[model samples]
Target: MMKKNRLERNSNSYQKQSNVKEVWRRLRKNKGAMVGLVMLVIMAAVLIAAPLFVSYSSAVGQDFSLVLAKPSKEHIFGNDGYGRDIFARIIYGGRTSIGIALLATAASCIVGTILGAMAGYFGRTVDNVIMRSLDIFMSVPDILFTMAVVYALGASFFNLIVALTLAYFTNYVRLVRSEVLTLSEQDYVEASTAGGATSMRIILSHIIPNSIGVIIVNTTMNVAKIILYESTLSFLGLGMPSPQPEWGQMLSESREFMRNAPHLMIFPALAIVITACSINLVGDGLRDSLDPHLKS
Candidate 1:
């Protein structure tokens, strides 16, 4: 009996390992996802490494006399309206842009996940109250809502993050709630409950684990959206304040001269588009890989 139990456990372990390998194999089949993953890593490396070599802050002393200087030997990407090095600003701005997006995503994911878990786990009145509040937020257009929140809280970096966090957290709650609702009714969940597992334990260990694949795919997609939203806010003067050297703010400052210096708008816009696309592609690939039914 002991030998038979051990053999069965080993077989189960092997099956689990095989499943993980299968997921990776599926992900690798997606060429664009691999490309996106590589690009993001390269971009992250540039951001981290560039500042170490360049001594000045993103927005440092500028030479107004040289304002709107086109790309040349001295400054590869040229100078902005304040004559700050455009290349330098972009490099440094990466840090802030990526950092804020990450923080906002994290904040949203955590709050949404917790709320979603509670709402789905405890249905009826609890679900009604939480979901109705979510509906109110959903009723407002996201950008306008974000703008209002930022305007009210004041346009500092921390406040902007807080505003975005609140705006995007709704996605997580809705997603997790849907997953939890489905999983909570599954046979495994019923078995857990029958085996005397508490509600919290069943929710955390069984329901959450089952829902993680959906959560991960949603979170990855949200990262890209958060980045775009951050840039938009910055562009509108509602995100990073002036002279801070953010891509969006940079675009805002450079817009007037866009007719003369097209490069200004081109580079930042390209950066935003590429990054967002890459993230989205990877998210799609991951979602496919995680869903066994989609595997072919």
Candidate 2:
């Protein structure tokens, strides 16, 4: 019996590994997804290694002589009005922008997942209460609501993250709740419940795991949305404060010099566009990979 159980466990593990490999194979077949993955990896590496090559002080320091200097061998991206290295600032700014997006996405996912699971598993009063709350949040225009929160809370990194998370988390709650509602009706979930498992246990052990595919895809896509929202807030002066290397803040600072110093705006805008596109492509690939119908 023990030997047979061990063999069964090994077989199940092998099957799980094979399933993962198949998903990777399908994801790799997507050209856009591959390109996006490469781009994101490159950007992440650059951001991680930036501080090693460029000092933080120099990236944010002022040099009156180098102010508004055009792109050259010394300053590949040219100097900003404050004479800080635009290239360095971009590298550093990527850290802040990407960090905020990732952190906010994670926060939303956690909060949304628990609430969605509870609502879906419990139904009735719990479902109505949670759904109604989410509806109220969804009723507000995201940008306007985010702006109001930021303005009210005052602009800071934590507040900005909170604002963005509050504005964006509704999607995850709704998505996860829908997924859970469907998953709860599956045979396995019914079996678990019949086996004397509590609602929490069934929701956590069976329903959530089964519903993870859509949750993953949605979470991946939401990263890009969070980045854009962060940028908008920073551009509107409701994001990170000055002296911090944030891409949106950089763009906001360069608006006055756009005509003569177009590079100031060009680089940051390109970064945002490329990052968002890459993330979206990745999300698409994940959606395809996780779709049972598309699996080979």
Candidate 3:
């Protein structure tokens, strides 16, 4: 009996590892995804390591004589309206925009997963209560909801994250709930129930683990959306406050200088686009890699 249980555990572990290996194998074959993966890795590394190489003062210090200077050896991306280094600001700005968006999306995913698991697995009153309560949030347009929250809370980093997370709540909840509905009916889930597992245990140890790939894919895609929203808020002057170099705010400040110094708008806009697109590409690849139906 002991030997049989050990073999069963080993088999489950091997199967899980094999699935992970297969996903990686498929991801490697996707050219666009691989490119996105590389770009994201390099960009994130640069943002995290930028402070080590460039002083923070370079991003904020003004140089009257160097204002609006074009890209050159002195400043690879040139000086902004305040004569601050564009490259340095971009590196740091990315840390705020991407970092906050990523964290908010992750928080949203966890919240949605928990609520979704309860609704989908339990059904009946539990389902109605969770789903109906969330409907109030879901009914509002996400952007407007986010705007309302940001407006009420005041537009700071923490408020932005809170707004984004709540605004994004519906997406993952609906997704995970639907997934759990189907997964709860699977044979392994039934087997676990027959073996006397608690509902929470089966949901946590079985359902949620199986649901991870889908949740992850959705979360990856949502990061781009959150970044865009953050930028929009910044552009509207409701994002990170002045003196805090966010890409959207950077673009906002460059409005009057479009004809005179197009570089001001161009660089920041590129950073937002490149970051969002890279994440999107990765999400697409992960979706294809993890879903057998999408395999080519």
Q: What are the root-mean-square deviations of the candidates from the true structure over C-alphas?
A: 2.6, 1.6, 1.3
Strongest candidate by lDDT = 3
Candidate 1 is scored at a TM of 0.91
lDDT of 1 by residue, 1-296 (tens): 99998997899789778878998899989998899888888988888788577755634668887688899998888887777888888777777887888888889998999889889999999899999999998898889989999999898879878988889889989989999988888998999899899989988887777778888898899889888888998899897776777778878888898988887877778888888898888898899899979766
lDDT of 2 by residue, 18-80 (tens): 988998999999999999999999998888888788888877889989989999998899999
Off by over 4 Å in 1: 1-17
lDDT of 3 at 182: 99
lDDT of 1 at 149: 97
Over 41-90, each residue of candidate 3 has an lDDT whose tens digit, in order, gives 99988998998988889998899999999999989999988999999989
Q: What's the C-alpha lDDT at position 54 in model 1?
A: 72
TM-score of each: 0.91, 0.96, 0.96
Clashing pairs in 2: none
lDDT of 3 at 47: 90
The lDDT, on a scale of 0 to 1, for candidate 3 is 0.92
Angstrom error at residue 26, model 2: 0.3
Ranking by lDDT: 3, 2, 1
Q: Local error of candidate 1 at 102, Å?
A: 1.2
- Supply the global lDDT for candidate 1: 0.85
